[model samples]
Target: MKVLAVSSIGGHWIQLLRLMPAFEDVTVEFMSTKQSFSTMVDGKKFYSIPDGNRWNKYGLVKCFFAILKVVETSKPDIIITTGAAPGLIALFIGKLFSIKTIWVDSIANCEQISMSGKIATKVADVVYTQWGHLEDNKVKFFGNVLG
Candidate 1:
């Protein structure tokens, strides 16, 4: 199975990387904001998309189109993300394309699922919250990197 993992920098990126060993035998590709971020991700294919975040509305729009292009070319069978916003955009596209999607809300949001995670519940095949207390009918809690 081909899995495309997408996440922003900082904690989101770190958590996504920790999930790598789990995808060992599968074809995995990565998408992020910077080439420097690609340094931690060795061997696998990495596509550096435009840098964007919640405050950068313009950048997010550009990144959205860039993500669309990547989705078209890479044609990932599944998409997973530890998100902020960019990852959410990719999940939306992945859903529209009929690609399976997973949204792992950041461990930082221990009390509640992030806004993006709440939105993902409608589209993603699965939504995971690292905090066990947050688990419900839609979100699953299956431990985390911190554990």
Candidate 2:
């Protein structure tokens, strides 16, 4: 199966990388806010999307289009993310394309699911939370990626 793994930079990227092991048997491509992150993936296909948050409407629009283009070109069977904004955008785009989507909320949100994650729960086929306490009917606790 072809998979597009996406996230923003920093902790989200790190958490996404930790899930690489699960993609070992499948074809996986990486996408993030920073192009420099391509190097960390060791020559695998990589895409860079604009980084945005709820505060930056313009940037979010750019990110949405960029992710839409990537989804169209990559044509991945599944799209997964450890999200901030870019990942959330990808998930929405993936759903539009009828691609399976998975969202792994950042481990940093120990207290509650991030806002993006809450939104993702509606689109993603499966939404995973690092904190067991955060699990509900919509969100699932699938163990911590960092650990």
Which candidate number maximizes TM-score?
Answer: 2
lDDT of candidate 2 over 1-147, digit per residue (tens): 999999999999999999999998999999999999999999699998888998999999999999999899889999999998899899989989999999999999999999999999889999999999999999999799999
Clashing pairs in 2: none
RMSD of each: 0.9, 0.8
- Candidate 1: list runs displaced more than 4 Å: none
**Per-residue lDDT tens digits of candidate 1, residues 6-122?**
998889999999999889999999999877877787788999988677789999999999999999999999999999788999999998899999999999998899999999999
- Which pairs clash (backbone N, Cα, C closer than 3 Å) in model 1? none
**Clash count for each candidate, listed in order shown:** 0, 0
- Badly placed stretches (over 4 Å) of model 2 are none
Candidate 1 structure lDDT: 0.92
Write down the TM-score for model 2. Answer: 0.97
Q: Report the poorest 10 consecutive residues by lDDT, candidate 1.
A: 34-43
lDDT of each: 0.92, 0.93
